[model samples]
Target chain A: MSRSTPLRGVHESLGATLTDFAGWQMPLRYGSESAEHNAVRTAAGLFDLSHMGEIFVVGAQAGEALDRALVGHLSVLAPGRARYTMIVNETGGILDDLIVYRLDEDQYMVVANASNYALVARELADRVRGYDARVTDRSDEYALVAVQGPRSAEILTALTDADLDDLKYYAIVPGVVAGTPALIARTGYTGEDGFELFVLNEHAVPLWNALAEAGKDAGLVPAGLSARDTLRLEAGMPLYGNELSAAITPFDAGLGRVVRFDKPGDFVGKAALERAAENGTRRRLVGLVARGRRVPRHGYPVTREGAVVGEVTSGAPSQSLGRPIAMAYVDEGALEKGSLAVDIRGSQEPVDVVDLPFYRRSK
Target chain B: MSTIPDDLSYTKEHEWVAGIEDGLTVTVGITAYAAEQLGDVVYVEVHSEVGSTVAAGDAVGEVESTKSVSDIFAPVGGEVVEINSAVVDNPSLVNSDPYGEGWLFRVRVEEEPEDLLSAAEYTALTSGES
Candidate 1:
């Protein structure tokens, strides 16, 4: 039996192709994937992301407990602010990458990947057994929706009383959306101006309908996971199962900036990260752009000359750029930008190693 | 759903075969159902060439979309005669008119085609049996 999100019926009504992802049956596309991807890049698009995991940490020692659990210092995060953090195991391998939001002095919410919800909740709960904080898994009760693109703010501000102009990037505010109490966060996986609204499961239908009506003239279309993958890859954002896993470290995954070594508390995998920093990481993630419409796919071997050097973790033809691009984890010394080849179904296709982001929004 | 043309014979794998040149040659392409499932074919790769003898169920080409990559198999044993260059440049033709202008290849039959499902049989294969 597959689980359904709060917006499952809405997706089905729009003639979306459904597939199982992270134990939830979600939409893969609606009509055409390229149209949805281009809509998010050029205009605006909405996504139902309620399948993500939401965990809450409460009590007086919440900040202290979070500091001991992840790599970042959550204590310094001011109220109404959010920071991207990582939870690692004893061997400096990433358990899951999450975003920490300081709801109040003693209250914090951690949003994580849907597939790693149980593991993250269990690990955090066990780590804080002696602390005063309590971990509560709130994934089922909440629903998340993302409105992303260049005109996202213009459309979203009409339905909420919150001051959208003051909400800086990586900020969160307690507010009401469509007459329902919700948490509106200025964060998204797509590299665009966007807001993530978390509302009660029962309120999702009304909120989605309200946003769709308000955003109709602004060129907002309902997008699915297929467009989400291509948009994030163009923005150089790493997907958890693709670019990150239990065996991948922060340094190797191009996420070293999220780690704080000078913090006063000893977090999990602190010593191992220190050692990894001293001796450089073995592999590094890089971006590759193919010459034509043939996109390099996941698990495709990346070779230089005739020697296999790495494998593509994510690849897609960017609807915004009209070309093929990918991300691959290669040796640290092989990070130089040059000519490369991607094995596409027993044939080698020429590629160029350029900068991280394949496309950037014009200001 | 569009009705499968009575003149064409279909396989269980959703490939359509139409007799050409008085049954000496046949044109092959994916059925409309297969093209609909494979949204927006971006690339098509042909592995077999002219004059190469192939067996039924052998992979002759591959079609890639934004979501998946699928193998295009031979519906009947034949010698490859011609490949469709138009679909290679504009793969959306497969979705528009799969049985007509979207034909994939032409082949010379090695023997009389057998074990193929008819249009009605192919429709039954996709009609909510699962």
Candidate 2:
């Protein structure tokens, strides 16, 4: 049996289509997924992200332990700030892409993907051994709700007095939302200005209702995993399983910047990452905009002149771009030499090589 | 619940058949339940073009949605008499009006269809699914 989030009943009441995602029964969409996708692009949308894992590391050596275990240099991250990072295996293959939030001087919260969080927690516990720190998986204790889009601030301002104006991007603040204590973070994967509220599991339904009520007039709709996937694809964000995998390195995915080789002391995969940085990658991630309406989906062969070069990682019909978009790892130098196409089933649908982030929010 | 028109006959593949008993030509479209399952339809391609012959259970066309793709099979052996170009241009009509504007094609029948389900039977089939 698949596990359900705290807001599963609420989603059922709203008539959401539920699907099993990463062993969790999550909302696929409330209604027309295109409507939900448009709502997030034009106005706002609320998301139930309780299935995401939250692992806490606390003690005097919390930052030090994280710096040794992960790719990013976490010791230098300021309090109440978050950084997008990743965890890699001994050979530099990405285990999971993570968001590390330095909640306080000696406390940090690591947010991981649902499918890989258990392994990530176990890895963290093992990596932090012999240090003055302890890793605890608190995923079951929390419920995450995100309000994302242009009018997210307007909807959140009415519910909380927590200076939304001062909450810069990638920053977190301790505040009360709808009379419940929560941690508010100004971060999102939708390429929109939004806040992620982390609260106890018991408060999930009430918080969802409160956000829905506050956002009713502001055109906030309940979005689900379908809309979320398209939105993040348009934003050019790499999903863990689809883009970054156990076989794909950060450098191969064009995310070599997340690897901090200059940090003090030896970290996991440091030597392998250094060699990868020096040798460069054979296949590089790039964006593809379909010239035709046929969607280039995951695992589809990306070809040049009928020769298979790489495969699509993530793809969807982008509401913001008004066409189908995809991210694929194509062999280097083949893109500049000739035109490329994605073999959708059997037909070679033409596509244009575009830059990452097919859509960017207007600031 | 998705609407299952009482007058139309349904295939186990989630397609509805109209005018199977009236004339040589019959209309075919995916059911609303199938459309809902596919999410927003982005592209529709009918492989069996007009004036083409097809056998029963032959894959005639395919519908591409945001998340999935499904094949549109021929309910009965027939000649493709007409294709819905409007749905080909604006595929969202498949989700908005699966029975009316989203009708995929009209096929002139060559043989009697076999094992097609009544509306009640289709409803029962879908009831077990959902």
Number of the top candidate by lDDT? 2
- Distance from true location, Cα of B90 in model 2, Å: 1.0
Q: What is the Cα-based lDDT of residue A106 in candidate 2? A: 97
- Measured with C-alpha atoms, the lDDT of residue A8 in candidate 1 is 98
Write candidate 1's Cα lDDT for B38-107 as tens digits.
Answer: 7767777667998899988899998878878889998878899999999888877888778888889988
True contacts kept of 2: 0.82
How much lDDT does candidate 1 score? 0.88
- iRMSD per prediction, in order: 1.3, 0.6
What DockQ does each candidate score versus the true complex, computed on alpha carbons?
0.61, 0.89
Q: Estimated TM-score per prediction?
A: 0.95, 0.99
- Tell me model 2's lDDT, rounded to 2 decimals: 0.94
TM-score of chain A of 1: 0.98
**Candidate 2 at residue A305, lDDT?**
90
At residue A284, candidate 1 shows an lDDT of 79
Docking class of 2: high
